[model samples]
Target chain A: MKKLINQPEDAVKEELEGVAAAHGDRLRVHTAPNYIVRADAPVHGKVALVSGGGSGHEPMHGGFVGLGMLDAACPGEVFTSPTPDQVLEAAKAVNGGAGVLLIVKNYSGDVMNFEMAAELAEDEGIEVEQVVIDDDVAVKDSLYTAGRRGVGATVLAEKICGAAAEQRWPLPDVAGLCRKVNANARSMGVALTSCTVPTAGKPTFELADDEIELGIGIHGEPGRERRKLAPAHAIVETLATAVVKDLPFGRGDEVLAFVNGMGGTPLMELYVVYNELHTLLEGWGIAIGRNLIGSYMTSLDMAGCSITLLRLDDELTAFWDAPVNTTGLRWGV
Target chain B: MRDTVTQGGLTAWLRAFAAAVARDREELTDLDAAIGDADHGSNMDRGMQAVVGKLGGLSPDEAGVGVGALLKTVGMTLVSTVGGAAGPLYGSLFLDMGKAAGEDAELTVAQWATAVEAGVRGVQARGKAELGDKTMIDALAPAAEALSAAAACGLSLADALRRTAEAAAQGMKATTPLVARKGRASYLGERSAGHQDPGATSSWLLMQAAAEALASDAPPDRPRT
Candidate 1:
């Protein structure tokens, strides 16, 4: 309820306007059906990468649009999936004659809309390939739920695939690499506080001061379990253990350790979580080859952090090391 | 004794659906809060409001517009306006139904059955959800099947639609014990059980609206317990 914004309804529009103005050198923002495309898009002969989801995850699908990440991103209203039309338009704008790749998160709305968009694009004779990221280890894979929710690894996938696309990888190859990243990665998150969505004007869930929600998605939905709040080391241990065990990551495997903060969590706490994560992995003998530690993906003003570990081989490690420049992530340029 | 549904009846069904969603919006959001994000009611209400507004623009004369076109318009509107998984799923249902109805100003009971079945199939295809998944399909699939069976039995359109509503209500209630296999609710794992699926609840309300519009002489705004 207490946030810096002019109006609840105008939150997405105003935020997008700010993004366009600030990052105008690297991206172009389109309205009517809002979408952000790389400023230098239609890169001749290279496959285009498009990814989007609900808007509150700043710098994700949008801020990541630039030289080495997503070519276009369609942001929906806060905590809402973007419509198919937005996806289709973005695909049309960004396709460089090498086809287009849609990096979709595995939420039902996201998957359905992106799939519909892919069909619509194909109808218009645009070759479109899509890969769904379901890297969150918190959601159990069972007959009761829609598998795992895509979380931190989505950012990682975009980065790796974007690098591959920059290298002029074919649509299929880029899509294939995306799937590989999804397959090799696992993520888990814990929330210390609930987030307040603008329109709702209240917290999505009420968390007692002494409790934490474990295995939470980015939308402020309650996690798998609620437990007494614990120290940073214990929290990181739980998250890291779950992700590491889910991937069954081995002692000799090389990994990209990504410790991501959910918007409200400060970098200080994230580093604390990262410190525990690093020590935990080191004890397990898993080598951390490349690392990204920050709030790359976040829920709106929620205090939490997620750990994503991508099992990397020579090829994936190379892509991870490739140069990149975007608002949310930048290095190796 | 109506043996078929006319375009006016289809429009009435949508209006009743809008009313029902508006009435039950908070209930749906409360249900969603337990296992999923708490926005199903608000999102569906917003979409249905747009649908009713668009429906109001149509001429009252049945000859002016076919049921397919009207339903397709509703689908498109919902797809554009509704922001969550429910939007695309519900939109697909109506769009596929419209495709199945195809240019018909009036549809026989059997034709309506075919359209409902097609709509349910479209939802399944778009959501990739199966019968046991605790989604809208839990209600919609059974209602579609029951409609088809009732139609095949040579029942009147009113009776078939009423039976479909009953099946949908039963399916909606059935979701209380199941584990969700799709959508955000699935994130809760075993904890998701015991809460009725909000999508299924909305699907039941829509089916009830159809029955009220086509099966009974009851007014659209009549309260249902």
Candidate 2:
């Protein structure tokens, strides 16, 4: 309840104001609350890319908004799904004569909402295709009564999907590429401490001083289990072991290594987690072709991180290294 | 007591439900911030807004449309408007409710209980979570059970929902003692214990609101028993 802000209701609005002032040249606020899009997007001939989810995972759907990534991003309330109207508006704004592509996380809400928006868009005479990211390997798919939790590979998925769109690949082909990435990748996260939402001004859940959760989702939700806190190296070993076991990066496998912070955890710890992951992967004889580390996707401010490994084939390797430019990540531009 | 719930009552219930959530959005969000993601209130608000929008130009009798159409609409709205597990759970609940309603134009109180039972079934199907899992199912399942029991006793809508509300409150309280088995709180393991589930708490509120708004005209009862 206690936090520095004009008002609790105005936090998201004020944040959007700041974002607008900061990135007005390239982005514009959609009629839908919290939606942002390229000021001159869809170029009327390019594939429209729209992605969004809860607001706490900032610099994610929003930060990734720009050329070579997403054409628009819908920033919902913290840990909330953007309304279908917002998504529909984003889809319309970025349609640019080409069909729109919705990049969605695998969370039940995100998938369902995007599906609704796509339907709404279709009703409006626009074509909409969707790509859902379900790359997290922490919760067993069979145990998932909801669905797979989309995690870090979202960065890679959007990046590669953007590339395909930039090449003017049709919606079906672009969607296919996204599915391929999702199918090939696996991620697992753990948390040391619960993140405090600005609105709640408290941790979403309590984590004991001595305990750490393993296989967490992006929302600072609990992982599969809580265990005594282990050394950074041990944490990485656990994550690597889980990811490899589920996806099985073979002895000669080449992969993209993503050591992602849940939010509050620092780059230093992520590096520590990464160093251990690198060593463990080497031990397994799997090669890491590219590496990305940061709080690219996060819970409110949860203290923890997730590790993702995506085994790559020749096609994936090519797209993985393709050019991408956005607020969160940029390369080969 | 006669069936006091009417077509107008249905619309009124939804309107009041939306208003209540809008009024307490932050409290709901605050609860979620404590034990889950901080978006339950906002998500519910957004979904309610969509629900209200969809209700526009529709009659109360039409509101009792098939559970599939109603639930599909409600589920899609929640999915689009709400984020986190609460969305899917509640969405599934409505999906189930709609499925139970199954193309009926109007349902008596007993029919409504049957509809709710069906909704509960769908939620269990979707969540695979049971009572005491520290999910919304905790409060919802019990409330549905109580309503069904009260209906079987031939009570009017008022008495049935009174029991339903009582069950929901008890279910809400019961959530405090159990370790969470689902959603964000489940990740906290033992630490997840202590705090009441925000989703389950709100589910109680939803049922309470439903009973308060839907009950037919009847004399007030005596002290709690």
Candidate 3:
């Protein structure tokens, strides 16, 4: 029930204020509608990228708003999708003459809001394309649910697609690249503890000390099933197997492996999980062409990790290696 | 009984809906906590509070614009303030309703039915959800249908609205046993079945408020179970 905040309602705004103060050189924070944009936006000839969702997943959509990533991010209340007005305002602000691309996670709220924004932006004569990320393999059936929740691959897609946009890819091309990234990626997570959204003032869900929720989503929603707490190797096997088999990733396949922390999970544990993941992939004869190990996409302060494996082609690999600078991710720049 | 709801009655309906949301916020959140992230109650409460705030500030001249303008204002307020699926869904309901109602300051019962139907259509178009999806549509679609049927039968405004509210209540209860095929609750699979959908429950409250507020002159009905 305890959080370091002036008030529960101000959590998103206050954090955004801090982001503005700390990353002023790289980004600008707009209030009233609450969106973050690149400090030097309207990169006139480049296809601008806008991505957003609920506020709890730190650094994502917002921290990623800088060079070689998202041009803007619309942040909503914690675990709540940003409204269409926020998205529309962001799209309008960041739309370079080329066009704008909205990278949306596959949650219904995120989808509907972004869809509405796209419609609004289109009505205003802006060319807009939206790509939805649904890489989580936890949800079994798209027919029965809203579909798999977007997870770790969102970080990868933003980075790669941003690089593509920087390369002056057209709106459709950038949107296509984003969809390619999502289509080739699969992710799964497991949570050791539940997170407390500030407004709710309680844990989202309870986890017994001896159990873990496997295939968890980023929002602290319960996953596929709860199981007895097992060792790192065993847990990694369940997660990695679900991901690899879902895509039917085969021997000799190359991938960009991402091991992400869910807020409260320390880097130490993520690395441990990554190590096991590496060993498991090696056993399966899949080549790890590149790796990102961090808490890039987190679910507030929940103790868990999600592993995203993105099958890589030469194009994707090149994009991954592109020079990038953002508050959350930086390379070669 | 009046055959139409004036602009004032429409405004009262909104206030009543907002009050109902505030009263049931915790219960809605509890329902969501069982199957989805537990924010439905608070999110709706925040949106409705914003709605009431906007309603309170409307100048007398502005308030005379009509039911359509008032509903659009409410919809925009909800879309901006409510951050979840309900924001767009409920906002669409009101927005499309407003669009259908046009600039009319008063609407006959048949006109109200048509507007409600349009609003439900908007919800479907926005969410891409269908009936039996264990969504707000479960309650709202049936209510819209009942309203249309009552209107076709030449029922009084109060009688039609009462039937609409009853249909919505029945649909809301029906959601308890259905497996969710939409929204966050869908993630739970079979586990989502036993709980009543927070969205449908809220929609039921909305219809209930409409019956009460828009038909204030009618005799009181039996207490709800």
Candidate 4:
């Protein structure tokens, strides 16, 4: 309720304008059917990578749009999935001669919209392949639920697949790499406070001061369960254990450890949580070959953090180390 | 006993639907908050508002315009404005309905039934959801079936629509005891039960609006509330 914004309705549009202004050198913001595409798009023979979701999770699909990352990102309203038309436009804009790869999260809206876009693109004679990430371990895949929600691993998949596409990998190969990354990665999150959506004008959910919600989705949806607030170490242990156990990440397995802040959490706390995660993984004899620690994925000012672990091999580790230039992530440029 | 639904009646149905969605906006959001993210009400309202605005631009006696064109406009508006699973699902529904209605200025009761059935099938195909999945299809499928059956039984247009709305309401209420098998609420597993599906509830409201707007004595230009 108490946030800096001109109006509730203009929040997404205004923020996009700022993103375009700030990162104009690297990306182009297309309006009408809002989407952000890399400035140097249609990289001549390279396959294009497109991913998108709701608006509140800044630096995700949008911020990641640039070199060695996403080619385009279509953002929807806050906490809402982008429509198929937006996705179709993005695909059309970014598709190179090789094809287009859609790195979609496994949410129902994202899946359906991307599916429709793919169909539309195919109708227009554009080749398209899609990979759905459902790496969150918190939500159990069952008949009652839609399946596991995609979480932090989405960022990892984007980076890895982007690198593959940059190397001129075919659409199917890049998509296959993305699927592998999603399969090997597992993530879990715990929220200390609920976020207030701009239009909703209130907290998404009320949590007692002494409580924390575990296994939360990035949209501020309630987690698997609420429990008494605990120290940072205990929280990290809970999240790490869930992810590791779900993947059955065993001793001596090389992995990429990602400790992501959920927007509102401070770097001080993120590092503290990462420190605990390192210790826990070391205790389990899992070798951390590579690591990323920051607010790569977020839930719009929610105070929480998520832990992700991707079992790594020579190929994935090589792709992870490739040059990348994007607003949200930049290294080896 | 009206036998056919005119373009004017279709326009009125959309207006009534918009008004109903605006009236129940908060309720839909509350229902969504219980299982899915809380945006269904606001998202649908925003889409319908855009649809009504577009409808206002059409000439009063646009004889060339037909039900198909009007419904296609509504579908495009909803797809662009509503930014969720419901957007694409509902958008596909109306788009397929428009296709089924073709260029006819008016549709007989059987033709209306066919269009409604096509819309429901479009949602099913788009969402890949089945009956009892606790989605909008929970209400839409039954209503479409009932409408088709009523039409086959030689019921009047108003009577068939009334039966369709009643079936939708029943299906909406039926969603309470069922667990979700698709969409965001499916993440909640067993917790998704006990709460009525927000999409189904909205579907029911839309059917109710159809029944009201397509009644035999309904005014073509009922003033917006």
Q: What range of 10 consecutive residues in model 1 chain B has the weakest lDDT sum? A: B216-225
Which rank order by TM-score, best down to worst? 3, 4, 1, 2
- Candidate 3 residue B181 Cα shift, in angstroms, is 0.7
User: Mind giving the per-residue lDDT tens digits that candidate 4 earns over A1-333?
Assistant: 789999998999999899888888999999889999999887889999999998888779898998999999999888888988899899889988889998888889988888888888899999999999999888876456777888899999999999998999988888889989998999999999999899888998888999999998898766779999999999889999999999889999999999999999999999999899999999999999999999989999899999999999999999999999999899999
Error of 4 at A279 (Å): 1.5
Tens digits of per-residue lDDT for model 1 on A1-333? 899999998999999999888989888999979999988988889899999999999878798998888989999999899998899999999999999999988888898888888988999999999999988877775556776788888999999999999999999999999999999999999999999999889999889999999988899765668999988999889998888898799899999999999999999998888889889999999999989998889898999999999999999988888889888878887
Q: Give candidate 4's root-mean-square deviation (CA, Å).
A: 2.6
lDDT of 3 by residue, B1-225 (tens): 467877667767778998999999999999999998888999999999998888767765557677788888888899889878999999999999999999987788999999999999999999989999999999999999999999999998999999999999999999999999999999888889989999999999999998898865432222223
TM-score of each: 0.94, 0.77, 0.97, 0.95
- lDDT digits (tens) for residues A1-333 of candidate 2: 445678665778788888889888877876445588877776767878889987878788888887778999988777767767778888887898889889888765577667767878999999888988877777664342345678888988988888888888888888898989988899998888877667656666678899998887776655678799988888888888988998777899999999888778889988988888888989989999989888988886678888888888888777767787776777887
Please tell me how candidate 2 rates in CAPRI terms. acceptable
All models: lDDT?
A: 0.88, 0.77, 0.91, 0.89
What CAPRI-style quality would you assign to candidate 3? medium
DockQ of each: 0.60, 0.24, 0.78, 0.69
Q: Write the per-residue lDDT of candidate 2 for residues B126-216, one digit (tens) a residue.
A: 6668887788888889999998898888887878888998898898888887877666565455666777778777787778777777654
Of the pair 2 and 4, which is ahead by TM-score?
4
Off by over 4 Å in 1: B58-65, B215-225
Residue A66 lDDT in candidate 1: 88
When summed lDDT is taken over every stretch of 10 residues in candidate 2 chain B, the lowest stretch is: B216-225
The TM-score of chain B in candidate 3 is 0.94
User: How many steric overlaps are in each model, in order?
Assistant: 5, 12, 0, 2
Per-model TM-score (chain A alone): 0.99, 0.95, 0.99, 0.99
Off by over 4 Å in 3: B59-62, B216-225
How large is the C-alpha RMSD of every model relative to the true structure? 3.8, 6.2, 3.8, 2.6
